[model samples]
Every structure is written in C-alpha cells, then in structure tokens.
Target: MSLDAADGTESADRLGWAWPDLPPGELGAPSPMFAVRHAEAPLAPLTLPSGDRIRAIARYEDIRTVMAHSATSRNLRYEGAPRVTKGLSIEDDPASMLNMDSPEHTRLRRILSGTFTPRQIEGWRPRVREIAGELVDTVAAASGPVDLVEAFAFPLPSLVICELMGVPAADQSRFRHWTELFLSTGDASAEDRVSAALDFAGYAAELIATHRERPGDDLIDVLVQARDDDDRLTEDELVALVFGLILAGHETTASQITRGALRLLSHPERWAALVDDPGLTPAVVEEILRYDGPGGYGMLRRMTERVELSGGVVEAGEAVFLLLPAGNMDPDVFPEPESFEVTRFDGTGDRAHGPHLSFGHGPHYCLGANLARMELQVAFETLATRLPSLHLAAPATTVPWIGEALIHRPVSVPVSV
Candidate 1:
C-alpha cells in the first residue's frame, strides 16, 4: 500500500499513509500510518483535515531532525499553528515557555530551571518510593481485584505533584477533574471545561495568596517567592505556569504507568523477566516509554519560516506533527523495532534505541523525566516483587483506553491481588 507521488512517478510516491477518522486512542494501535510512513517513506507531506499542510516525521532520524531543528518554534502564535485547545487563549499565545521561541523561551524556561533541576527531581526519589509503596499496600489491603489505573497509577503521580506544588491532598479530586476537562478532546461540555478552568485558576490564586503570607518549601512557594524577590513572572503567569506543571506532570506520568503495566502484564514472560532481575526495570521503563508512552507526539511546533523537509516545502507558520510511535518502529534504526526487548539497548548491534522521542528531544524535553523515571522504576520493582503472579484480569484488546485524551491510558487495568 503506497501513495502515488505528486510527480506522477512510483519511486517518488514512496509512502502511503492510511490515516483516517479513528478516535484518538485507536490511532496508537498498529495502523497503516506506521506501515506506510515508517516502512515506506520516512518523510512525507500530509494534508490535514483543515486543508492545512504539514509533514509527518516518521523515521527515527527524521523525527530527531525535526525536534532538533532551530527553524521549528513551539510558539503557537505563529500564523498557521495547530490549536491545542479552544478553551484557553494560551493555546495560541506565545506566553507559555512551551510555546515561546528562543530569547523569551530561554528567559521563562530559566525561571523554571533552578527548581526543576535534575537534583531537585532526584531528591524526590524517597518520597516517590514511599508513595508507590503506600499505594501498593492500599491496594493489597483492598481484598480481591483492583483497577490499577484508579487505585495506583492515577493517584501516585497526582499525590506526588500535589505535595511538590504545596497543593493539599484534599484538593486533588477537584484538580484532577479540571485537568481532565482541559486535556479532553471528545464531546466534553463547554461549560464543564470553562467552569473547571475558572475554578482551578481561582483556587490557584487563593493558594498563591496563602503561600505569600506563609511561605513553604514547595514548588509553589518557591515560585511565589521568586515572583516577590524578582519581578520575573506576573501573578497570572505564575498561576498558569503552576497549573500547567501540575496537569502536565501528573497526567502523563499516570497514563504511562498504567499503560506500561498493562503492556507488560499482558505478556507474562516480560513481567516474570523483570521480577527475576529487578535491574532490568530501568531498561523496561525506557522500552515502555518508547513502546507506549503517553503523548501522541511531542508538542505541536510551528515552522518559523519557509523550510524544506522530506523534499517538500512547509511555508512559514505551518505546523508539523512528529509521531513518536512511528519513529520508534522505524526499521532502519531499530532492528525489528516493534518487538519489545527488555534489554533493548545493552551493547546490541550498531543500532541503539535511537533516542526514543517519548520524553521528546532538545531543550523542551520533559522536566519531570527523572521524577517520572523514579516513580516508574519504583512502581515496577515494587509491583513485580509483591505480585509476582500478577496478570491482567481482562484480555489485552478488551481493555479500554481513555478516549480523546492527551495521555494514552487504559481506562481500568484490573489485576488480582
């Protein structure tokens, strides 16, 4: 299955992408998109629904090229950029560090740097271990079966983030609801989304006020103190930034943990192998991230100027979507890329994992990668040790994935204690 090139030659028409109107969750499944773009043509021009043009960087090298390119700007304020969401003006505003270009991005990102450093994230390891252990115990005490997503995956990251942000444990339920509404793409009620954002913002504002009077050692307190000490970020920016971090940090990590567990548990051999050798846990974590990480692709970045990619020219402002899963399966890079190898990169052949773009690449790589890794490493080690015989209670294909959600997740992974 190949697409005919515009040049009317078979050689030029090397790729054929059978991308269709499937729901978001289903898109990650083995689709023609992978078979065509990754197997046939690594670089291909794709016409999106809105008649806008963008190129899909499917091959590992191509994906890295796009992510590492300077011409690409994460700023959404560009003329023809993908709309992240309709609710917030930040979707198109170049204010968020994730949406800004060089100098401004550098300035805003620096504000977040001192706090989210590797040292700070690594310091949270003990707490992450404690949270993972506590959650596992809670589930163990609960009798027969447990929905891992609800019981463990969802809360561990959420609680850790709340603690870090100085958000109270009691407020997480409402915070979780609002974060869901913001990231949802299905038929979510307009009122639900807007109302949640307003309430969440008001709550953040109140939290900031409280922190100002009584400063603490949490990230939120740090931000507020920074705001006071240096005229760096405004009150609104602080609110938005914290809100963004809370949502981004928790949601993606939760989803990945849930999905990764299911991915391994469904294959008992993999689960057993990890249990047999706990050291393989880290490699397994990386493989899971590469295999089924949350985030459809990295953030939507726009072309700052006219640029040529894959023998096609993307005019300035056009947005490019780098599908990470496709890149992970590229044959040129990873031999038999689809197969899950626990020790995938331990002195293998000439090919390495080739930088799974799951955490993304370049300066905008996930700030919480270390924290996420710590949480995941602890998660697998503990779960595998405790529930050695743990297997998916339900069939793999029957497991439901969260729909139209930014993070890929199983709705409820049922497991017997």
Candidate 2:
C-alpha cells in the first residue's frame, strides 16, 4: 500500500476527508462522518496535508487493538515519517516518549507515571479544588461577558500544571502565549509555530536549570533528580520530556474545560442537574471527555507486522491513525453515542458503558488523566455551585471553534454569570 496520495498513487475515492481540518458538529461533538465511518469504512485512508495517506482505524475494537498492540510502533523518528502537519509538530521530536515504543517509552513513562497515579493525583485534590474555586470566584465577580477561555478554562489547568511542574507563577502569561501558538493550526504560521515551540523549549530548559540549582518539590525537580541520579534519560530528552508534559499536560484539559462548560451551559437542565448534586461531577466530567474530549486527530502509529483488525487487515510498515473520538462515539460500546447525558456512565464501573478510549488505552494511556479529571470535576462543580445562572454570554453559535489542529479547543469561550 503506497502512502503517496499527491501523485494519485492512492485513489481519491478511498480516502476519508483530510482530518484535523474538518469542523466539529454542534456543541463540539466529533464530525458526523466519524460516526458514519464506524459502519461504512472502519478502515479508511486519510490524506494528510503532505499528500501522504494513512489508514484510519475507526471502530472501537480496531482502535483498541492498534493502541494496545505490541507489534505496532509509534516511532515517528523515521525519515519521512508521516508528518501530521507541514511544520514542526510534536511528532517531529524524537526524544519525546510520545514518538517512542516499548523499553524506551516504557522507561520514561514509568519515571513520570508515579507522580500522576490516581492516589498521587488525589493528594493534590485540595490544591486543585482551591484553584478551581478561586478562578470561579474571579469569573463570577467579573462584569460583562467573560471570555471563559481566558478567565477560566485555560488558566485553571495552566495554573495547576505549572504549579505541579514548579513553573514560576509570574511566567504564566508568556507560557500561555507560546502554548496558544503551539496548539494552533491555521491561525499561526509554520515559522511562527516553530519559533514559539523553540522558545518554549528554551524556557523549559531554564526551568530544568532552576530545578537543578535548587531541588524543589515539583515534577521538574523530580525529573532533574532522576536524570542526575540514575542517568535515566539524556539532557535533551529531559527537556523534551518536560516540554512534552507541559504541552500535553494542559492543552487538551483546557480545551475539554472550555467545551465541557459550553456543553453544560448550552443545556440549562444539565447545568441545574450538576448544581443540585455535586456528586454528579465525576460522571459529567467523564461524559465531557467522551463527548468533547481532545481526541480530534487521534494517535499515529506504524504496524511492525501485519494484523487483522475488526475492520480489516493492516499491512506491515503502514501508518495507521487510531481514531479515539470515533471509538468513543461507537454506538455498540456507548449506547446513544450522539446524546450528551451526564449519567451515561454508571458508577458501578461495569464493562457495559466502558473505559472510554478518550484517555486512550494500553501502555501509552494519558499520564495526566487522573489530574485532568480532577481539574474538570473541580472546575465544573465549582461553576455550578458558585454560578448556577451561568449561560453563554453570546449565542452558542457565536462561540469560535478552531478546527484545523491535532486537538480541538475553542478560540474563545464566552459566558456570563
């Protein structure tokens, strides 16, 4: 199977529409075509801006297989490895665990995993709760329509991740600017994106230096200590790892917060339901991850061996895109996949509804999932409790959506209390 789609090596009719470029349906749900593809073409080829074609594994089971499969490699360091975009994307960083597989990836993941475990994350609950409450108070007091993205959504996670990583509080505004460009697709130019990313890497290096000078009580300190003690990962890898965490730590969570608030606010009953019962916060957060999670472009991998999927057979050395959002939308796995129900996931934790792949599956599952859930739960609970009358400052239609990106986040989420 040739990957070239630019010179007509692959038939145009077989390709799914170029992704990360498609607009989300109402309220930031995945494109309807993703749901349709689960049945019509579970294994679909998608054309990239580079004109290379990668197979999209759209069904829930197929996606799970790809993600958990040992034979599949996420090694994007190969020459001409399928570029997610035309510029220097996160995938281009070979030192990052995101682009590695097996032992190397496993090692780095373990080093950072201990900090993000459910129990460890729970330890930070008080701080996360405090941050959420303070932000809500600020948003509640602000007159006129508040840009939730600026005032609440982005900041809450930004602060949490920064604090967790031991970033200086004063540098957060500049940090936001770099991350904003790093996450942008069409809004920022390729050169601009590269510059921002480089600047970010430099800043991360400085943080590492600071952590080295005075071993503090944060993740960067832990990583710096790990590197000096055991020679775990190289200095460059250290910087990339920290940089990767900073970007992954908050970008999607911020997006989820923005979309989650908008979704609940759009439906007054749902907002009231959460307001009436704070216990419903966890379930609502899960549903938000299911309905509007940062799984837009999905993960990219190449099969090291031929494998049969729920959809079809994938050949060796071929690139495949695991569509996590589509799997979350799988009607078989999640009944009424289109509906936005807070209680969609029962508290029993049964297999009926599922372990949504929004957080992903297997070895590479999201490291910050626990922390992210904590942030979202606290954010939503705080909002509903503090501002029950919260509604979109403008129309839901007026909410700006940035479509062309690896993840989905609104340009600005506006609201009023």
Candidate 3:
C-alpha cells in the first residue's frame, strides 16, 4: 500500500501519509519520516499516494541550497504539475513574483520594494506600537479570557496591511474572510476553498477597479500606477500581486504572533527575560520564526530542470516538497537546534546574527520580513509589559494545530490578561 518513486524507494512513510490523517493532538513535532529519510538519505525519492514523485530535501544546508539555487523555481502553476490544491489556480495559473522565477519575479519585486524599504518599515514603528497598544487595551477591557489568535495576533497584521493597502474599515471583515479562504490549506474542503478563492479574486478585482477610479497613497495605488506606467505588470498580474500580498502578508504574521506568544508564555523563564530586556524582542522573534513556524511541509514546488540533489536526481517539471521546519531544527547547522535561544544569534560585541532559514534565503527571502520583525518586537514588548499576568487558560497540548496546514494557526489561545 506504500507508494514507490523513480528510485523504487518504497515505504509507508511518504510525506502524504503524514497529513489529513496526522495523529490527533500531535502538534509541532517534526515529521519523523522526513527526518529519518533526511538522516539516511538527505534527498529521497518520495512517491506520494497521488502517484507523483517528489524529491524531499530535509537537511539545513541542502534545503537552503535548493531554495536559493537558480535551477529551482517557485513557479509551480503550470499545467500537469502535482498541485497542492485541486481547484485553486495558485498551482495551475501563472502566479505573482512569489511563484515566478527571476527576471519576471525580480521586476515585480522591485516595484513593491519601494514601499517596504528598511527606512519605511522603521517609520512604521510608532504606528505598529499604536496598533498594539489599542489591541492590548481592548484585551484588558474584556477582563475575561481571550484568544490571542483572534484578539491580537490576527488583527495586528491584518490592520497593519489594511493601513498599508488602504483598505477601509467597513470592508476589512470581507478582506479577512477572503484571506482565510485563500490561505486555508487545512480543514477546508476543496470546493469550499476554491469558491473562497474565486470570491477572493473577485474581491481583488473590485479593489483594483476602485483604486483605478480613485487612487490612494497605498501600495495598491502604487501597483496600479506600475501597471499603467512602467508596464511592469498587467491587470491580471496586478490583481494576482495584490492578492498574493494580502494573502501572504497577514496570515504569516498572525501565525508568528500567536505561536511566538505561546512559545514565550510556555517558557516562563524566557518570558521573564524578555520582560526584563525588551531589546531581546528582535532575537526572540527570529527564534520563533525558526522554531515552530506556521508553514511546515505540504506545499508543492517544481524543479525547473534536471539536477542531482543530495543522493537523488530530479528531472525538469518534477515536484519537490521541502520541510523547512525540519531544516531549521537540523543539528548539523544549529547546536542544540531544538532548544529556544534568544541570544544564540546575538554575539557579544560582534552580535553575529545567525542565519535563520525562517524568512527563507536568497531571492525568495520573505518580502514582509521587516514588517514582521517590527510587529513581533512591538507585540512581545507590549504583551510582556502590559499584561504581565497574561497566562494560557488551556493546556498547551489541548490547543488544536494543523500539522498538514500550509500555515499553522492555533485554533484558540485563551489567555488571561
């Protein structure tokens, strides 16, 4: 009953076997199959039950090489590829820069880079702090238990992006729903997910139209101009880009905030340290990105050409499923990789920042990294300082986690403020 790959490797431990049927309540554990395979054969031919052959890269350096290699590409939306979702065009149609190879990817990335400049992100500090202050104030008012995911984590990035993209308050709820639909790779029916994606695209089209009619000073307005002036992107490209921004921008931050908070809350000593020295907020955020990040395994990426990887050779048009969390926790690269260390990257005097594969590396490095960093710093500082008594209401293990999800979001993080 186990699937076989081109190399005739057969095992009951295919990556697909780990999902939609993962052992209930086993959240945040590395895929034992992947870990073992990587240890024995860092690159193994994995035969998915769907009859697709994928080269699974698991080691830290190898994974980073594959992600940053010119031969590999994020563009997986062509015909005949093994798709992550059946009805969603994200795997079938041409994607934005995130899913494109260079030249095209670079061109699109450049237009938006202006807004996300380091200086610009730094400028957003006070606003982000203000946002955090407001959310914490509201949580304090509730007095009763509150789910950090819904109350703070979700809204912080959602509203930040809303402000960035100029989305109005009245329309933000709808935006939130569309975002959840597009990003949901767990627990959503294919049909439901597809319908939501269509609705999401439809929503983008409306926003594009509105921006075209009455341009604002937000990123969308800038993108609309890029489409019209520089001819950098087409209308479809513009819509897809904006859609990608909203989808990728908010959910990832939400996961980090919720998961990162939970990690700190669970480790009281670390929590206390952060409270004492707020400067550790940035390093703590980096550690969170490395540890227990939301995006785990299951996202399918295609090989741009035939190449030898680790011990296995993959051909052009073939698909690969990389387990990033596995790579992040690789002992070969990170000493005591499993242990959460805020100062591991921050060396004394020199402060050598260790490479965290969290934001990814090379060309595909996360676009919103600066924004995510700022949010996390403000979030942790505010939460630790404001709600010193904040503690998890439910047992950490009792919280639901989607091991197979494209993004890991805690079902509920009830906390007392």
Model 1: CA > 4 A from native = 3-32, 41-53, 78-80, 84-90, 188-191, 346-353
- Candidate numbers, best lDDT first, in rank order: 2, 3, 1
The alpha-carbon deviation from the true structure for residue 118 of candidate 1, after best TM-score superposition, in angstroms, is 3.0
Worst 10 residues of 3 by lDDT: 1-10
Where is model 2 more than 4 Å wrong at Cα? 1-21, 49-51, 347-353
TM-score of 1: 0.87
Q: Write the per-residue lDDT of candidate 1 for residues 1-417, one digit (tens) a residue.
A: 564422222321221211232123232343334646665655565543223345666767666766778888776664546554444434543445676677776666787777667688788888888888898888888778789988888899989988988988888788888887766644344457667777777888888999898888888988887688888877767887777788777888888888788878888889989989887888888878777766554346677777766535667867777777777767777676667788885421123345676777777777777777777887888888877777777778778665454454667898876
lDDT of 3 by residue, 45-136 (tens): 55442345556677777677677778887777556676554456465557566677888889888888878777999999999899999999
lDDT-wise, the better of 1 and 2 is: 2
Cα lDDT of model 2 by residue, 40-152, tens digit: 77887766544566778889888888888888898776776787666788788878888888799988998988898889998998998898888888888887889998888
TM-score of model number 3: 0.88
TM values, all candidates: 0.87, 0.92, 0.88
Better of 2 and 3 by lDDT: 2
| Highest-scoring model, TM-score | 2
